[model samples]
Target: MSQYKINVTKLNLWYKDFQALKDINLSIKSNLITAIIGPSGCGKSTLLRTFNRMNDLIEGVRIKGEVLIDGENILDSKIDLLSLRKKVGMVFQRPNPFALSIFENIAFSLRIQGIKDKKKIETFVEKSLKSVFLWDELKDKLKSSALSLSLEQKQRLCIARTLVTMPEVILMDEPCSSLDPLATLKIEELLQYLKKDYTIVIVTHNMQQASRVSDETGFMLLGELIEFGPTKEIFTNPKDKRTEDYISGRFG
Candidate 1:
């Protein structure tokens, strides 16, 4: 099998007449955290959304490029969106847990797939929570409303909900943006644990978080990928002047 999990070749995107992403190319490795970092409105999140074709939800969006997952082009017109989404689950900037019991939140995906077996759903719920280190704390409160949990707990629960579907890749778009420092640290720790089992791509404006949690880092500027390399190299010794400037607080 190829070491790389996702590949983007000559990718470009436009919202109506305004281009959002310039010719972009990168390869993301399997079972590792890849961070996309840039200032506001630099298309960091836009490129992240392309992996699952989430941009399709917007009106007047045009894309021309190849985004391949497991050697198959997901940008193909005939691709299965439902299956793609199932494989590439997403966690948003804020914890948007459903207004349901904690148990039901995790089981929601399984229920949607027509999985009515109680035993099976129960097993997945336990396993998913365990993966995110929430099983111990939440097992007793399974019937409680998810909204009642603390912010960090809620974010962890959201991640657990994604895990119940057995996705290969997890896309986090500024997942810790709304989190407090302690909570963000906890989430970053969870990312380290998760990298062993799933490929993770994160978009963040937090430079320290990117350096701390990601194995690979890609820097963007004005809708273009300016630099991409091992996190250590990208931070310590970037090849591109633009990347160095951004990393040095010269300019975003």
Candidate 2:
């Protein structure tokens, strides 16, 4: 049987003098998509970063409780940080590609893991690009600089780069916020296809996107998780007043 991809218990986060997350508990099923939605500064992004320990790098940051991946606590001291990051890939809100050729950008992570086989690297690069439906558009420009691609293409390249390392869980922070409507639709379609093979956690302000892309939707407000369940239930018949108010566009 497949195990839970990520489990959080009584999780809380603080940035020195300010608290961002308050006792947030969530479980992400294996090979499924979970969307975190809330207004700005509501701690949706903070909770997403906790899955991969991205909060650890912030100065004066303190966390309480446990975050487990595959039955192991990633916050434990004995865990190797590098390996953990490899297994939990992250794609930021922007398409921050490297200043190199398209092929080089995709090959960067594999090379870091000490994979030096030329032919094998090439094949994997191609395969990863194809996973994001970008191989056909980029195959001819393998050696061209990544900066030459369109914004949507660059975002897809970032997805390809993350896939090259074969991460079990992918954390996306407003990944489609910068794209046009058509490009956003394509990414939403891609997310549906990718969830069959990898656990996905996405933070989005777009209510419609969350409803369309996530199997489970979590509504957070004022640093607290107000409601979480099947997307249909949360949207149609939320138990919490806060959830209803936010979803109904009464107020954020």
Q: Using TM-score, give the best candidate's number.
A: 1
What's the CA RMSD for each of the models? 0.8, 1.1
Against the hidden reference, what TM-scores do the models get? 0.99, 0.98
lDDT of 1 by residue, 108-175 (tens): 98999999999999999999999999999989999999999999999999999998878999999999
Model 1 — TM-score against the truth?
0.99
TM-score of 2: 0.98
Q: How does residue 228 of candidate 1 score in lDDT? A: 95
Query: How far out, in Å, is residue 70 in model 1?
Result: 0.2
